[model samples]
Target chain A: MTDGLPMRVTATGLPARVRIHEVGARDGLQNEKSVVPTEVKAEFIHRLAGAGLTTVEATSFVHPKWVPQLADAEALFPMLRDLGGEAHLPVLVPNARGLDRALALGARRIAVFGSATETFANRNLNRTVDESLAMFEPVVARARQDEVHVRGYLSMCFGDPWEGAVPVSQVVRVAKALVELGCDELSLGDTIGVATPGHVLALLTALNEAGVPTSAIGVHFHDTYGQALSNTLAALQHGVTTVDASAGGLGGCPYAKSATGNLATEDLVWMLDGLGIETGVDLGRLTATSAWMAERLGRPSPSRTVRALSHKES
Target chain B: MTDGLPMRVTATGLPARVRIHEVGARDGLQNEKSVVPTEVKAEFIHRLAGAGLTTVEATSFVHPKWVPQLADAEALFPMLRDLGGEAHLPVLVPNARGLDRALALGARRIAVFGSATETFANRNLNRTVDESLAMFEPVVARARQDEVHVRGYLSMCFGDPWEGAVPVSQVVRVAKALVELGCDELSLGDTIGVATPGHVLALLTALNEAGVPTSAIGVHFHDTYGQALSNTLAALQHGVTTVDASAGGLGGCPYAKSATGNLATEDLVWMLDGLGIETGVDLGRLTATSAWMAERLGRPSPSRTVRALSHKES
Candidate 1:
């Protein structure tokens, strides 16, 4: 296995091994109208880790008023921690208060999210762009002091629902700020899933030129427009080693009315396996996990891989 | 606009423009369990042409005993000819009898189907690989003599359900025979939707090295495992300008149990538009057309673009 180098490019021009940052428990469940029980959420994470995901975003520390679906984060985090696996359970922290709650629960890694566009920042984070960055600054600083790894998420990096197509320079400036503020990794998110491979290549190339190492870059894509896999390929070709995916293709953007599911972990794993890239994930286990979760959700998984495999199995 | 010259490669290593050969009416509806009315089928072609699709495959001349869905090809072809748009209505011709029926209906363009793998050739065409090629020889020669354009379809070029992962050399041999037999173009079919981008690049590279022009290669992909668009991107990067897509993501291989819909035309058009590639299809009308057809079929369109646009409009 290759070390977690910032820019590990293989002979085939892709990462030798990719870290799939599982967000199904956090991002995927948060978007659902039906609130999942805390126990079910914990089991989903356990199953995901059992499927070989090293990094699992367990829960978010947002206020219940904002995200009632994840209101059981406090109850869920300790259960996930008690499972005692090698997986990194990262929690989403909106500000210092959320970080403090996560710290009290012994979260070793936490993520802070900001928006690339002002409208999204105001709507999602309830603050101006400067205010949102200011909000995360102390949380990131405190996490660094406590030896906690911080991952930063920049949403709408390609296009915004209100602001339309975002400039690459705008994304680069905010990404640089997050790195300077002690974020160990930054995820460029297509929140509305409007990105194509050309936009992905252009943005990642510009970010590299602006001094953000590709190794510290992860891509979080939604499959609303069916471009996630193609966009992920572009990211890998540019030497980005971390990718964010949701099991059973869970999650949808609340701001973008037309957006659908996140890039399915099973679909991503299938492509990586086909390309002969190492992901340390078992496709059969992942497929079974998604199928199990899909039954709990009382609906079929939107992932083509999950559907194809499930249909084949049945 | 670039000429349809064989082997045209732009500086960006992509074709300047792609010719979308719409296969909705024939290959798409042919697999449906419910028979589409001839009038609705006629309207679908009219709407597709109005949306600026230059080459639309109308219906197949295969005997209704084999494909009852396209039983009205005789009635359908005459109606399509009376509509009289710039679209080329290429009907599938199974053999000399099918070709004779198409000729009697004044069909100017037709496509013959073959198989790359031996088992698939025997199972689908009821002949061995050599026997299948021999069966198409006289049909292609006669079509060429009548000044009618002919396209050849090579199924299981990437993978066969019966005999897994067909070799690239086998596909090249079959493709070369079609071209030598006066087929104007060859559409390589991933009948099982198991192809990844790496396989696509390798196969296309082998074919080009084998003296087949890139311009004459069209990719027909299924979205079963969500690899169609990614494969299409790889094909375009290799300078292949022709793509086969189905409106509303219609079509499945009745022989292959797991294969799903063909790559949706609207989805392909969205990516092409985003990449700044010129495809003369109108996105709005195409969405409307798919939505209208979906209503007639009593289901929502399987196309992500059509769904997204319809959702946004509603």
Candidate 2:
């Protein structure tokens, strides 16, 4: 309870350590209506790395026209060169061109986004599911050739806003394809946040059956329906170690003003810390960093843990 | 995805059906800074029952001096008499006087609140833990004599704000004392919202080893740190059937302006519905009810489900 920490009480059948794939700099800020200054984004990532987050997603290399909020990806990536830690800066590469741009700047880790369902694939990437996979094929191959750590982000793994229930087999097929295409890890995303614990376990079970090891899989859950933490717990129960969360739950849902987007990193840390799972992240520093970011965002943080901890400090 | 419903996918070894103990009318509003009118309170309860919640805690019969927000309990109980349904209206009775008042109003069910830690017991009840338990003994005895159902609410069962990391043994001692005093059910409360899934499972396991059956246990979790739903999932995994929640997350925390209170009913329903567990509650109707209450409270609901579903409607 001192410094807003939960008492450690380890559970059976869970990984001892979880690597938090901090997505605040990329996934979080991308959804912001206003563009954050490139320096601020760099400082945010630096703060995240300083708080002990090893893998901090820097920014997306998608076209500036599509995501103006992260238009300074070229400028922002260079500022993080002095982050000075064992932190891995992973940037999202949309295609071969994006990958080329990321590689020119010495990016060591890259992630390719794909959709599990055709409807989402068409909506998000403006291509069919197969077409999106085809696009990622060359990019992933190129990244693997250069010894880059490639993470395949499969969106709408459980339920789609348009397609409703996504078949587990469909997700497995794409996930297997991503791994086959030389991706080192796959991050399963509940895009609309419509998944439950059973669905989470079912999907993970299906992926394992399809030859994907638990160690190579991560989970990206949104808190749109407040299922993120519970779903994360279910994922942990299934031996998945990497969890994607936004610092201060930075990505607010674009569809609704009140709807939450990504799962808050602080909230995830609270659960992990309480369960005796180490994420190497400092809770107090992370909360302070998120609070600082929220102030910059001109809004209060959507993270319950951040708010609770910051309120205590105040 | 129509009407904002999650696709059903069942998890193994979970209860086929869960009975939701709706506490919005009592525990939720009791923490409100301003008192809601008696008519509005009665209407809210009716709406909740209409939405298929079987057990709705109506109000607390504690002295008005302590809880002025629910002081209209005397005026509210009679208004619910005309509520035609299978719904059970339970009320909190602080002492013998409160029990007499509820019994006179023909209350069929009553709950006595006790604190597991001596600090909380002394602060909340103005007596030692043993002394508070002794006070509840007569009230529980009297209620049982009248063939009334009794629920013992053990607050700060997980962690206390003043005394951090409450021991599992200490909670078990108070819980056993409550059962020995003739309580029919025990609601273990995470009053400070500091519990993780492992802590939840550990406590449940310890309670079971101490002779408290899962059948007689319920979980009441607060969302101060966003662990309520995850903790509830852990409790459900341990075979707990009754889960407590507040409609629209009605109880905002008194300690912090940004701190959330109860596990939101909408959020819980979203998880249970997706798990394919029968709760007999309509998600659409329940969301509408909570939204209506939130309007009356003049604040947006803290429930992620409520916001997501209500946003879809707008």
Candidate 3:
């Protein structure tokens, strides 16, 4: 509705409208110890969609064994068939089998991931970056044949838990491969949250130099180092439009061993508003959703902004 | 000696030493829900000084009726008498009465606070900004008479909780007044953690224009908005050297009525190291201090960097 223009109102006059992809229902819930009922996830997705999110990562179509927490995704997807909102509910599909499962559940949107570091790739997918890319090619092709829009995730773009600092070229190599393979958008994820603003800018500059369009790039950062939003600001300065965040700061990356949880959606929106970037998110609604999710999980949110602001209003 | 530099690593190539001030034993404990035993706080302060902090804020001398949390100041100061191991113990003194109490207890160093914003001045001390300065002048005058090295605190320099946005002129006006009052060093506090790098730069610029020496300025920031380290970077870029941080990010402003805790000393040290500033402190020891403090308080640290880095090593 804002004409896809970056210009925002009355804050800083920089172009606004940063697209936010709420990954709470899937990415947030996938690492929980308790089994969240399928109906609850379905309702969460509906509520998120209603809260003005243009992209809600609905659920991952991976096997029940690998992610026992998301075992309900199979039933949840089919039960929540009515899309009353306009956002894309893209599901994660690791390979041809996962893509088949998602398609069987009538999924029209899917995302594939390849780690930028060989260590992280093998650690997560039991394959190297090239091998993971090879595996994802056919999945992307199949999703395309079904007229599904494919997104790509490039993990460990900042640092790998096993191999240490991931070089910008490694990130570019995987991101370029994903972009060239017809993935519509590629998200660079700081899985361990160690990326400084300098690292973010350097990697983005490398990708920009390699001729990847900035428009096709998204950022997924963790607040482990308290640099997520600052890094986001740098990304925005470099023309990155899409960002992935979890409600209530849910979902720690168990793969990183003991890293901080994903960046909080409410916190991200709070910063974006201050910077005059529109996320089309209702702050009050987001806070409500996060509070609901926090209570369901029996945990306090990892979001300081949410906690601070909520207490002030009361 | 780190050449008395704010963040410079080598004092003109003489090898910089980073100075850490342990505020947790005092500021951190003062705001906690549980009143730690006098022995516990004394032990904590002793341990902190042993861990190599050159300056430790021993305790505050505010009215016992105002902050019952530190009412044990009567019992606490006597134990720390000649107890500092290679460190200077400074106590927070609010008024002439508080100064007299500290002087009675052999407190040789004291910190006095004056707010830039009228709203904060009223809320914190039930006085106007000028009225607050009037109160500070007599304390500084008395400290001079007692040969006390007075480090003045100018609260709400960047922003205020009740006042919303504070102008840089307002801050400079107060800072100039504090300097004129014979404060040896002035620490500007972002009381509610509402400062951005831009805000820091604006205030510093105005202070510089007002003939305030950067060498005489220190920064005290809260992490409520996750901008403390970044603002610290801006400070370094502007040549303001002294910094005040709580041991575990424990020093929340009681006046702000928010959990706007002080910048974690460990995290501050981490950033300073990355920026090549020589702060003579062991990161591991600082982390241990915060972690230990958190466990004692029955809570996790308010420091993102400390939590992330500590977990990574574990």
RMSD of each: 4.8, 1.7, 5.5
What fraction of the reference interface contacts is present in each model, in order? 0.35, 0.72, 0.14
Against the native complex, each candidate's DockQ, computed on alpha carbons, is 0.33, 0.67, 0.18
Which regions of candidate 1 deviate over 4 angstroms? A1-11, A82-85, B1-11, B82-85
Q: After superposition, how far is residue A145 of candidate 2 from its true place, in Å?
A: 0.9
lDDT of 2 at A218: 95
Best by TM-score, which number?
2
Ranked by DockQ from best down, the candidates are 2, 1, 3
lDDT of 1: 0.86
TM-score of 2: 0.97
Candidate 3, residue A269: the lDDT equals 72
Report how far residue B67 has shifted in candidate 2, in Å. Answer: 1.3
Question: Candidate 1 or 3, higher TM-score?
Answer: 1
- Most accurate candidate by DockQ: 2
Best-fitting candidate, scored by lDDT = 2
Q: Cα deviation in Å at residue A126, candidate 1?
A: 1.1
What local lDDT does model 2 show for residue B282? Answer: 86
TM-score rank order: 2, 1, 3
